[model samples]
Target: MSQTATILVIDDEPQIRKFLRISLSSQGYKVLEAATAGEGLSQAALNKPDLVVLDLGLPDMDGQQALAELREWSQVPVLVLSVRAGEADKVLALDGGANDYVTKPFGIQEFLARLRALLRQAPAGEAAPALVQVGQLRIDLALRRVSLGDAEVALTRKEYAVLAQLARHPGRVITQQQLLKDVWGPSHVDDSHYLRIVVAHLRQKLADEPAAPRYIVTEAGVGYRLMG
Candidate 1:
């Protein structure tokens, strides 16, 4: 089913577009291409592609603007492609509605892996399950509630967002910058301490032993993963 997913690749660079078109098409995906943001949006609306590959630098419109505009009308997942590798740029793209960001000169293998993960976590058309049981913790995404065994757990907005993000991916190691951007917005991307604090709070709430958490495992300087 993943191989059959359609993707729209939007970039001003003909070479990049050609490369991705061939690469993705060879993998069994129906690839659509557009040279500008306007065309991309038009194609998206018309085709309703399963995923979008958007370039940040567009001649007619900024990539962030396009993401925001598309998000206003559709919840289709968007993956940003940009020359800018700055944490700030990544944060802005993610905060503006991009599901993921990849800098230029990216390895094809890494890019493909990221694409797969993003698609795997794409929201389903039908309603999601109200109760999500992962390991020893139970989460009610609809009600924004959590429980550990028989005890009700309390979590802050940020903590819940972090936990939910991890829950969405299960074993995936979500980067610190990505979590920061997704949970705290673009402005707080540089503040790694914020993630630490929130993660600690979440562990305290969900883990029997905060120091040796079973569900929320830290990946040192990398990120956090939810071990199911």
Candidate 2:
């Protein structure tokens, strides 16, 4: 018996909320609406939704501040939607604990795909499988071993962390701040150089070319995604 997932949509725009409600309910999702950050935060605490679709523009409170406060108490996956499409805005949201970011005027298909990707993450504390495969690459999550075909590829802990996270979400983009914060902790979210170096090392070990990368692909100013 699969119940529809509940989604908390926190956006101040009435038209946007109605659009999202209709769009989400069409797919059998239970939609909860909030017109302000305060109300949204309150609803999230009371409802404990399966996922949150948050807008960065709110009337009562700064959306970023709300996100940071929510992060302090909740680990629910947040997909940030905002009209601010700047690289810095994306970086700040991701570092502030958003799972992903989508700029406004987005295509519905892409938005739903990203939403599905966010919801697919395994819940915390469940044992991750020891063996996982993506294409020709095999990762032993328990042993922390990675191999291509029959040859083992040596990787540092940080390199393996990056690879494993991407593997967990195959073909989906993992924001740089999310990766950095997960692997190196919260303080290093802004240290883009460190993440780039690790990814470079992982690519080298995997024999992937940045020009036409087969394994790891950069998302220009956004972040990185694993290629299928």
Candidate 3:
């Protein structure tokens, strides 16, 4: 997929943009760059890149604002980069609409891994599978049915929503905010406890232990990822 993929890099620092352009280009990805938020937005609308690499500190606008604006019209995957390492900053960005967050001064390999994970969730000119199999679980998205082995596992509406979201992006981390916004509503993004309660119920029904999860893997303060 990298061979024909396009990635947009929005960062003010010349060195940062240059480094990303080189790194992403070397991986057979077409790289588009913008030094300002406005330019990035324009590029994103016009070119419609597969993924975006955004920096929080921008000359024209705050990266979070840019992200919110982007989310309004587009569902493109966005991987945010910031100098701030605080958990709050990460949570805010995730809730604001970022697909993933990576701290500054990050390793190129790890960055590439995160980028690939986000790309995997992007539409690839085909519809997602109707049936997703993960270990002992089977999810039939079209019918909104979930089964473990031969027995059907009944789930609440919210529980099914969360599981389906995770199932769709198996192995990719879905932020609490993203899940809340997608499942509950935008106003409920900050209500992490609502998600926690739902997840607890799901774990109980799925027979998944929080100590060593076999399906839903918690990312602590970040979010959750479904592991097959």
Candidate 4:
């Protein structure tokens, strides 16, 4: 079934679109291409590809706007491709709706690995696990609620998603890019500030000390790990 999944590639650069089309096709995925955001949206609505590789800078529309539009109508996984390395850009894209973000000049192997991970986690078939517990925090995915000890904690939608991803993989060092992509969607992977802000918020809510956290530990220039 995985072998038959269709991946839509949206980019203004012919080179990128061609490269991804060939690479994805070589990996046994059916590939579709679009040169503009408008075209991408049209194809997405019609074909309903299993996943989308969207470039942030498009001719017809900015990638972020495209992502927002897509999210309104579809739950299809989106992986954002951009040259912008700013943390703010990453956070904005993720906050908007991208599932993952990859910077320009990315290593092919790493990109493929990230794509595989996102696809593996995409909502499909069975119902996702709803209840996740880490230390004193209890997350009820179904109810979109979190509680630490005797107090209820509040989180933004993206915050909950980030925590959920970490809680799902306790003790794992989830990369900043991965967390950004997973929580904010793909477009925000490069926006590390979103991750920082959200992590800070999570630590404030769940950790014994926000400065020196027990549950969420930063690896410093690497990523974050949720200690079990």
lDDT by residue (tens digit), candidate 3, 105-211: 89999999999999988866633445678789887764568998899999998999899888877889999999999989999999999999999999999899999
* Count of residue pairs whose backbone atoms collide, per candidate: 0, 0, 0, 11
Tell me the deviation in Å of residue 200 in model 2.
Answer: 48
lDDT of 1 by residue, 29-136 (tens): 899999998889878867778899999999999999888767745678899999999999999988888999999988888988888888898887832233568776
Best-to-worst lDDT order = 3, 2, 1, 4
Per-model lDDT = 0.83, 0.84, 0.88, 0.80
Candidate 2 local lDDT, 61-175, one digit each (tens): 8889889767644678899999999999999999999999999999999999888888887265423333567667887653457999899998887888898888766678999
- Model 2 poorest 10 in a row by lDDT: 122-131
TM-score for all models, in order of appearance: 0.55, 0.55, 0.55, 0.55
Q: Please give the RMSD to the true structure for each candidate, in Å.
A: 12.1, 14.3, 13.4, 12.7
Worst 10-residue lDDT window, candidate 4: 125-134
Looking at candidate 2, what is the lDDT of residue 43?
82
**Using lDDT as the measure, which candidate wins?**
3
Off by over 4 Å in 1: 126-228
